[model samples]
Target: MQRLTVFLCCIWIGSLMYGEMVAFWRPYWKCSWPPLQQNLTEVPHSHEGFKVAVITDPQLTDYTSHGLTPGSFAVKAIQFFTDIYMRRSFRTSLLSFEPDEIIFLGDLFDGGPYLSDKEWKESAERFEHVFDQTQRGSKSRLTGIPVHYLSGNHDIGYAGFHSHKREVIERFEKVYGETNYRMKIGSVEFVIVNAQTLDGSMNENSTSSSWNFIQNISADANPLPRILLTHIPLYRPNDTPCGAYRSSPIINQRISNGRSGIQGIMYQNYLSEDTSARLLDLIKPILVLSGHDHDQCTVSHPTPNGPVIEHTVGTFSWQQGNLYPSFMLLSVSALSSSTTSNPEGIVSTNLCFLPMQTHIYLWYASLFIITVFLLLSWPTSGVDLSYCFRKLTELAATAIRTTSKGGVKVKDEDANYEYDMVWDAEGVMHLIRKGYSKLSNANHGEVRSSARGTVVARPAAKKQTTPESDSSCVQIESETNLEQIPKGPRMTKGKMSYIVQRLFRTLHNIAVLAAVNLPLYMMLLIKDWT
Candidate 1:
């Protein structure tokens, strides 16, 4: 018993020491191992080359940004959301240091449709509120330097839906330029292209090389660095029978509504569309900036012809629990500064991991439970070996007798716990784990797509549950009835309370003994060594 107690104490102490380390422990995980990228890159238009910040798909729908209903809040699945905020913060901070131009990649609004008209108005109002805040003032990255923006698939009504798509565009154009235009910071030229047209993608022989329209500007310096701004990037090679260009969005819900018989088709516009690759091959300019994927990544490629570097800035807010926020801050040197101090250096990227508030709470709770467990194993110096043995044996016997009859029966109050359905984002149903003891054991279908599209061949979708529908019927269970209890060493609040109280008492007794016997413990150590 003494040896066992000593072993357990040693283990508990080790755990206690590492508790803080584990609490803040961030695992070393990089996105996309060996990121599929090309090496041999170059710095384009070094003289007037400036760092431009890009952020896309803020997706501030009623549900996402300002919670759909009053007092409504959405929690995320994991830690990535912090990355989203931190990435933006980093970019902003860098802008403070490097003083670069900035741009929003687009999709500023999410969920253009609200079932209730009130909800729709409220959603639009909230968007204007926050976006105004984001776009206002000279202290922010948007205002301090030159901040430009473009439109995203989500921002423009997700395809021909009646909403504030045009209004939103107008608001943006009023602050920035008219969605599509050009500007020259110095030797490097910037062309803001609104690639938000729906028919640009699906319709065959659409005479829109919308990207090509920007290149024809008379003010554009040929063979000088030209940076292109776009929302969706096209890098994947086109495989359609028509042999179109390609760079596929991982999962694309159609930008328009003439759906094929599927959820949504994954597609790339053009391998070398008006993007950095094509711009590099054509204008032979330097860099390009884009947003939409909301993941921090930089790809520098050396084509057989020339080299190009492109960076994708992440989103600024948490969405669907994936925190991806990043920015590009550049120090634009005059053509004279090319020969001065180091031209390009990465100011801090402030890629903060998601905030650990929730995880920390659970961690501390588990540690408290474990500490109580350890203290119960402590030895009592006052009792003789035989006396201690007798006391433990008696307690053990009493526990056995109590447990044999019936152990830990759950109460009726627990079985009657209820959960309330709140807002209607696409995926809040899966996040019910936040409310403890409210989970139903229902087997849902294997499908993950929340949308059903035409032309895109996907499995049949499960219908959305209405207020009148019995969603509870879809829950899985081992037994047929709702109130059926499983046969086991059942858990009970009363039993847990009793166990916890006992552990607490044990901890108090151990602490008292340790304090009182400090001198004796030291003397014993000396004597034993001697």
Candidate 2:
């Protein structure tokens, strides 16, 4: 029991150290910047493309989920821990890659749309805390990099649904700037669209504004290659694959009829096919980046210009369904001259994964269970538990003797009576027999007789029970039993059985540990490879 306790303490300490100091930062160390066509080192500083960190679907926790109730300790604890996990990942990524800009692909909060004004403000504060740049020191990498935000269905409800109130949209815009806008960072132009409004099922005014924004951007005859950033992904067939890095193999698209379907206000998998086509046609962007499905997906949409690639980035928070949270790094550079062969300079992307938080917790849990099982089932040879108990009783009698000397009376007869009562109540003799039977064969049946004799002899002490007297009696009885016990063949067989049991136990424990942890390791390795 003592060994098991120490083992558990060591495991607990190791888990805490790894989770806090090592796990969150290890992935970033393993990941490198996505390579460009022309080596970045060879290019001039002005022409070297900028790196953008694309984070999506963080979906910060709120009272609506995780069985969290308002004003409760559990809710506060969960929120704090979750926010810290996200903050650590973000900070580590910034420090590792030092991206020139950052983009949040939305679903910033799980209950953003439905939260009350006070609740909404609190959630927004948590969002700021998770992505805060001001707190980081001047020496920090990516110290003043700009971060852009997009509106998600969770942030502002799906357009045309009853949940899509004008006030909700206004609240989001008030805090996060305009939902539909365009900006140029480095040499590439990025068009940020509120794809939720493109559904056109409701909120006519907002939907109209979104369309106008798209039309205005499309009308501009800019020479720079355009990249579209939106919260919802462009529509694709239900059978579309989300690539090897996606947690789920298939992307299921579910569309609902206006106000008549079982799907609630929150059920949107992708943009409507018509809206997708309209955005593709008007924007005519060279690339599209979106984040609503909370997983990595890459698909190509055909256009007259060429095939436009759309990459849906995965979530950034571990609280979401994804076990391995990740973000994308996009390297974009502008070309010096426009040509028929290649008008754009270069754009390359790579998905960098975060630690598997769920798997780490599983490791801790599995370790505890394995430790407990081994401790309870471990083989012990010739170590008598009853003898330990007898020693404890003798110690108690010695303490009582000292107390009696100091003018406190503890009767010898009473002590003996109490000891016999505890021994019978706990069935110590029965326990000894059961323990010995595990290691002793039929030839070692005499061990059980010796254990029974020890118990019977204890009850015979009716006159006076003292530590010295009990110790002398037990020592003489033990010696006699040792002399009478046969030691040649029977003892040799018991020793061999004990050795075999220990070997089998060790092998079984190894197999169990491998079964529990091998798949997790394989998954991390495979994801790293892809």
Candidate 3:
């Protein structure tokens, strides 16, 4: 038990250290820098490119998922651990890449569209806490980095559905700013679009507003390379491939009507074909970035002008059905001279994968199971108690022989007789009777036993014996008499006491183990609870 306890403690400590300090951070160190599409050195005195971190589909847990009940302790606990994980990953990415700006592609909350004002507020608070970089005294590397957010179906519901309530949209915009807007960082221009509105099934006003936003961007003659950021990916043929980084062989394009009463489409795998074509033609974006599938995908859309590459960034949260969650790092350098052959500026993008949290959890679980098995099987693991007792008896016999003084030594022939007559109940009774006869003879008196109508007397011829043999005979007789004595009530009480003692010992062991390891487990879940 002591050994098992030590082993379990070691496992707990090791797991805690690795899972918390090493596992989550090692991947960042190992990740190579994003590969640049074109060498910036060719451009005369090209400046360092702007680095942007693309995070998407965190989809923070809510009442609707993970068997969670609103306002319950379980929900809070799950949220707490999940938030801690996200915070660690996000912080690690920020420190590793040192991105100048961060962009969230969407689905910030799992059930944001359905949450009430109070629930929404709580979820938003959790989101801020997870991504908080400006807390007082926080030396976070991302403290001053600008963050941009796009509206997801989960955040503001799909367009054209009554569930896509005006209140929800307003609340989202109030916190995250306009979902559809344009911003430029360094030499590149980013056009953020709310693709949910492009479905055309939405209200006339919203549909036109989104179109007008796109049209306005398209009409601009700004020569800077344009990048489109949206929550939904542009449409492609049903058989289109999502590239090698995708976990699934094929992207699931099946349309879901969902509970939102948006007939024919509740959630979309990609934007409608017409909407995708229009955006490509009008915006003429050199690159399209989106998130909704929660997996990495790269697709090329053919256009009259040129082929546009679209990268669908994977989810950033480990809970979103992805074992290996990741984010994108994009670096764009604006060329100093537009006259150069390639004027769109050198762009490089890489997918930075976070540690596989599920694997870590499985390792912990396996360790726990192994510990439990060892503990439960410890009692009977090895050693034969009966054999040990027999060895002890033999040692005691040898001790008695060694301590005995010199006496008459029996002949070899007599030794076999003595052994045969001194090892059973009847033989023991005969020995006791014989000794009594000898004592009676020494006293010069006849002996008689009337208890069972039996009589005994010493024989006329006397046999020689050793004092050791006499003492052993007496001891064996006394033990036999004691065994013959009844101890029914005492034995029953002793057995009950033994069972109770064993139960207490098992419980004590389990309690000690739990006490020792509980803190370690809690540290893994809430290391930054404050």
Best by lDDT: 3
For each candidate in turn, the TM-score is 0.45, 0.67, 0.73
| Residue ranges of candidate 2 with Cα displaced over 4 Å | 1-12, 39-47, 135-138, 162-164, 201-203, 257-266, 334-344, 377-530
RMSD of 2: 18.3
In model 2, how large is the Cα lDDT of residue 232?
87
lDDT of 2 by residue, 1-530 (tens): 34444555556556655765578678777887786666445466666568888999989887786767786988887776677778878875645677888999889999887899999998998788678765456646556788889989888877655333679888898988999999886667889988877776443788778888887877877556678898989989888877788786667788655564522334678887888888888887888999988778899888888898899988998888888788999887744324212423467788889888788778877876777576546545434679999999999998888887994655554332112111332355421111111122233222123433433323221233443332321222323446777879989999899777766665665555456456654554333222
Q: Relative to the true structure, how large is the alpha-carbon lDDT of every model? A: 0.44, 0.72, 0.74
Q: Which stretches of candidate 3 lie above 4 Å from their native place?
A: 39-41, 44-46, 66-68, 135-141, 162-164, 201-203, 256-265, 336-345, 379-509, 523-526
lDDT winner between 1 and 3, please give it: 3
Candidate 2, residue 426: the lDDT equals: 30
Query: How do the residues 1-530 of candidate 1 rate in per-residue lDDT, one tens digit apiece?
Result: 34534554554454433332332223112211111111114233422334544456666644434444443433232222333233323332333343366567776656443324455455446444443424323755454465566766555433233222235444445544566667765445566666554224433111133444645653345333456666765353333221111122333322333344322222233223344355455544355566665654455557664555555555655543333233344434333223332213211122223223345446646855665555564443433769879999999998898798687533444332223332223233332211223335543333322223111112222222213323332232223554576534455766787678767667664565445444543453333222
lDDT of 1: 0.44
Give the poorly placed runs of model 1, Cα more than 4 Å off: 1-52, 64-100, 112-146, 157-168, 171-177, 198-215, 218-224, 238-257, 260-284, 298-305, 320-324, 336-500, 503-530
RMSD in angstroms, all models?
26.7, 18.3, 11.2
